[model samples]
Target: MLKTGSHIQINDTTLRDGEQAPGVVFTLAEKVAIARELAAAGVDEIEAGTPAMGDEEVEGIAAVVSQNFCTRVTAWCRLSETDVDAALRAGVKHVNISAPMSRLQMRVKLKAEPDEVAARVTRVIGYAREKGLEVALGGEDSSRADLRDIGLIAGAAAKLGVFRFRFADTLGLLDPFSTYEYIKRLRDETDLPIEFHGHNDLGLATANTLAAIRAGASAASVTVLGLGERAGNAPLEEVAVALPRTADARTGVDPTRLMELCDLVAKASRDSIPRAKPIVGADIFTHESGIHVAGLLHDVRTYQGLDPAMLGRRHKVVIGKHSGLAAVRSVCAAVGLDLDNSVAARVLARVKNIAKTTKTLVPDARVRSVARQELEGAETRDMAPARAELRLHP
Candidate 1:
């Protein structure tokens, strides 16, 4: 179990791995702006970009590095000196030197034995440290690698002054149970700070990431909106909010400003935010069901699992086919109209009919019109008895 008050660090890779999303490209200004926002949101680190992509990419990374953000800025590099040289040109003080750790990756991709991969790790990491750059080692596909080999590779890197070891779920294959066990086993092997970099192929990245933290990983890799190659990486917003709630861990990321940051990334990446996306979606805090609305009207806690107030937002009740009298009254009152129980019932009927016909929620004007008609009918019926009594008495 994760100890309370343990500080969990967020290493945001939106610019590096996130931009790897197909057809997604961020200009230099966009990169710098994102890094600035991440820093302001109290991200512990920013993975600026892969400088080995060439000079244009290097220049962009340099622009971000120039800001000298409060958060540490790092570049991603493969197990090659050329990659490290490119990062050096970009003016970053930190680098994550990655090497394939799995035997399959070693045989198919590198065409080398484990010893050769180990040799490359030592050389690249040593060069990075000699260049006066802080280093972290990424064990690519560590989830599939042999545990004994991971211990050997990571132990070597740790002895050579590497500060952290990143265990990446490169294929997004591991579930929460395996994730916990993976990190737990690795934790017993090395004292180096472990970071979990999870993918979302099975839509379990957030859960797996939290599990890693619970298993003693100190950091997590995240993107602004789970943006990455294939499905995506773990979403920053989900993990940030989930940490404090699930593990009693704090990331120092302001949950209230998370939506703003997500919007900025969405606009820059041209990736639309899903209406139902957790933590930063357009409709997560909206309610429409009659039962839920009634319960919320009586006590907000009844229907609320996570407080919207924490994100600088409030819960909203929208009228639809599932709406009830309580919801109709709540909507009417917002528009400066009071609906009695009978009138509210009538308006709710209209709301459901309109919603069914349109296949959407009813608007305020339509609901108000229904309530006006109901009130008018009530007044007409009330006057009929008085008028008849006056005529008979006269």
Candidate 2:
């Protein structure tokens, strides 16, 4: 487990990896805007873009760099001198130089053996350092690579004074157990700061990332909404919020601004935020179930795990098929209606019927109307009993 108060660095790759999601693109203005928001949200670094993508990408990266935000802005680059040159042109002081780590990638992508791959990575790290670029070496497909080979390359990069070694679960194939073991073994390899870059193909990126951190990785590479190639990468919001709670660690991220930042990215990418998405989801704090709403009414802690107020939001109670009398009364009271027990029960019945028919939450307006009708009927019934008693007395 991570030590208490361990500060995990958040390296957000929203502009680079996030935009790589199929059919997703960000305009220059949007890129700057996102970088601004990311800095304001207290990310430790922003992977602006891959400078090697060409002038357009370089310009985009440069635009973010020109903003001079306090957060470090870094460029992604392949393990080549040409890529490093592109990064310099983009005016970024830091660069993450990537190399194929798995034997399959080395044989197919680089067409080399272990010795040749190690030589190439060392040469690039030296060249980048000579060019005055702060460097982090990224091990592509590290999950499939042998631990010895990872140590070899990272150990070599360390000699040249690289700042960190990024172990990427490039295919998102590792579970939390495997992730912890891999990172733990890698820790014995080199003294370089270890950063974990995880993918979501297995839907375990966040879990794997946490495991890696517990095993001694100091940094997490993430993107907004988990947006990336294939399934996506580890989500920034999930990792940031979960670190303190689950790992006894903390990040610089502000949970309160996460929703706004996520909404901004979702809109720019033309992707709708899933209403049930964790952390920033619209319905994450919305309650409609009978048991849950009753529990919340009695004591919020009964149904509460993550506090919505931490994200600058509150719990919302809506009447639906699963709603109980407590939820109905709460909804009615919100609209300036007072429902006695009898009226509340009648309104809840109507709500369930309406919700069943519509296959949706019963609107507050409709609930108010039903409450009014029930109240009028109850009043008429009460007056009749008094009138009969008076007639008998006369």
Candidate 3:
């Protein structure tokens, strides 16, 4: 378990790895605007972009850097002089220099042996330091790499004065239990700051990230909306929100602004946020089930585990097929209709019918129309009598 007051660094890579998502691209203006918002939200760092992409990307990164936001702006780079040169040209002071760590990636991707690759990492990182750039060694595919190789990479990073060592679950293969054990072993091996970068292919990115922090990772790499290659990376919102509750780790990010920030990123990236996405979703806080809505109406804590107020949001009740008399009464009251038991039953039937046919919650206008029609009927004349009977039954 993490001790109290663990300050977890959130290094957002929305502008870098996020753009790698197919058919997603943020204009230079969008990049800077998003960076500004992230800074205002108190994100610790921003992985601006891959400077080596070309002049356009370099300019975008430079624009973000020029803003001089309180957050540290860094560029992502491969282990090569060309990539380092691109970052230098973009005027970024910090760079995450990544090299493949797994045996398959070594032979297939880099075509080099473990010792040779380690030597190359040393040489490249050394050269980067010479250029006065702050460096973080990205151990790509660390989840699949041998524990000994991970230790070797950490050892190299420590010896070269790398500020951080990132363990990349590039394939998103590990679960929370495995992730905890992995990071715990690495923590025992080195005193250097360990950062966990996770992908969400298995829908475990946020879970695995939390486990890593609990096991002693100092920072987490995340992307807004979990935007990245394949299923994307760990979402910034989920990780930031979960940190405080799960690991006793604190992030500087303002939870209230997470929805707004994610909206901007979704628009810029053309990736719509899921309606049930954690924290920033449109309907995650909306309750339609009768049991849940009734419980919430009684006491919010009875049904809500994570307080929506933390994100400047509140639980919402929608009248649907599953809604009960409590929900119907609540909606009627909101629309200024005094609903007796009989009227409530009539309105609930309509609500259920509408939801059943349309497969959606009854619209407010429709509910009001139904209520007015029901109230004008002869059955409503007995509403007062019905309530007396209802009270007696209670």
Candidate 4:
């Protein structure tokens, strides 16, 4: 939903660039399923795959095109006739044709002069337009490219009727503050629709993406669960959850299914989502601290920003050293622990010692086990030990 004047659209690349994550491959069936999910999640577009790859790649784009799930599917390609022919053969009507606008990509990769590549882009855009396919011009290494020359390349694409000009931090080296400044200047210079594509080598993709939107980016490229080559790209779920709540802009991502989508990316990608990942992590809503559990029992808002119920999650009170007496009582109430003052004291002492020794949060099952062992110790000894003991049962 557009609120007033928010500038944000999602061009998800989970199936395309995200699959480029080393050692991760998505089968045809897997790619189609993810494309459908991305469509269902309200993303504006999907960068399906590179058509120039092979028949398998072409078939994948066709599979997504066949579904036609209200998402525009585009292919990434060089600004060359061969790549354009492959894209057309794959039946994808939209393509992001690009070249090295930077001295790095142009000089090193293309090994062509600046003026030479710029004219080549214009010619290819005209060719794609003639083929009746919509186009987005990609400035491959704009982060390191001269800003004035970048604008000139973009203006050339604009002159050829390309509206979306994607500025890529191909090396994942740009910071959030610098990203905003450059993108802000870019928007002022051209009327083209700006899309920010960031990488996570510096672990700043999501942060920089947000800054880009705040500065006037039309869309931000993202992947599910932050899956991409090397350090991966900005996470689609994180960008969705953070932007609307944190920025003047908003995107159309389903907040409730954010975790479910994270799970989907993890399972399909065969990578485990971290337990502390924001918004959708396994432990994000699971409270193990005694103090936190106590506060949560009174009101979940005391411990969580968004309600667990909203994400179809239940709040769990686990026994840990950081937990207070109220949390202990709550977990016991949930699990029928029913401990008296003496038993509670023994359990609390055991929790403290365990956390201190392990240097980590104590788990609930361990607390319950310790309580049982303490009962056994008292029963066996007939009297409490003269000194304290924090012993493990197993």
Q: Would you estimate the TM-scores of all the predictions?
A: 0.96, 0.96, 0.94, 0.88
Report the lDDT tens digits of candidate 3 across residue range 1-394: 4669878999999888433588888899999999999998889999999998999999999999999888999999998989999999999999999999898898898898778788889999999999999999999999999878877766887799999999999999999999999999987777788899999899999999999999999899999888888988999999999999888789999999998999999888777988998889989899989899889989998888989998999888888899998888888788688998878898889879989999978876788789888988845675656344344553
Q: Global CA lDDT of candidate 3, please?
A: 0.89
- Kindly report which residue stretches of model 4 are placed more than 4 angstroms away from their true locations once superposed: 1-7, 17-19, 335-342, 351-394
- How many steric clashes between backbone atoms does each model show? 0, 0, 0, 6
- Tell me the spans in candidate 2 whose CA falls farther than 4 Å from its real position: 17-19, 385-394
| C-alpha local distance difference test of each model | 0.90, 0.92, 0.89, 0.81
lDDT of 1 at 89: 98
- lDDT by residue (1-394, candidate 4, tens digit) is 1255484889888888433689888889888888878888888889999888888888888888989688788998888988899899888889998777688778788777778787888888889989998899988878888887787778888887886999889889899999989898887667888898999999999999988887778799998888888998898988887887667677777777777666777888888999888778888878876666767777778878877686678766665567676766555656777777787787788788888888887666777777778767767787655877898998
Off by over 4 Å in 1: 17-19, 385-394
The model with the greatest lDDT is 2
Cα lDDT, model 3, residue 355: 93
lDDT of 2 by residue, 1-394 (tens): 4678989999999999433689999999999999999999999999999999899999999999999999999999998999999999999999999998899999999999888888998899899999999999999999999988988888888889899999999999999999999999898887889999999999999999999999999999999999999999999999999998878999999999999899999998999999999999899999988999999999999998999989999998888889999888887788788988878988888889999999999888888899989989998888884434445553
C-alpha-based local distance difference test score of model 4: 0.81
Per-residue alpha-carbon lDDT of model 1 for 1-394, expressed as tens digits?
A: 5678889999999999433689899989888888889999999999999999999999999999889888999999988999999999999999999999999998998898788788778888988898898999999999999978888888878878999999999999999999999999997878889999998999999999999999999999999999988989999999999998888899989988898899999999888899999999889999999999999999999999999999999998888888888888987788788888777877787778889999998877788888888888888888885434445553
RMSD of each: 2.8, 2.8, 5.5, 6.4
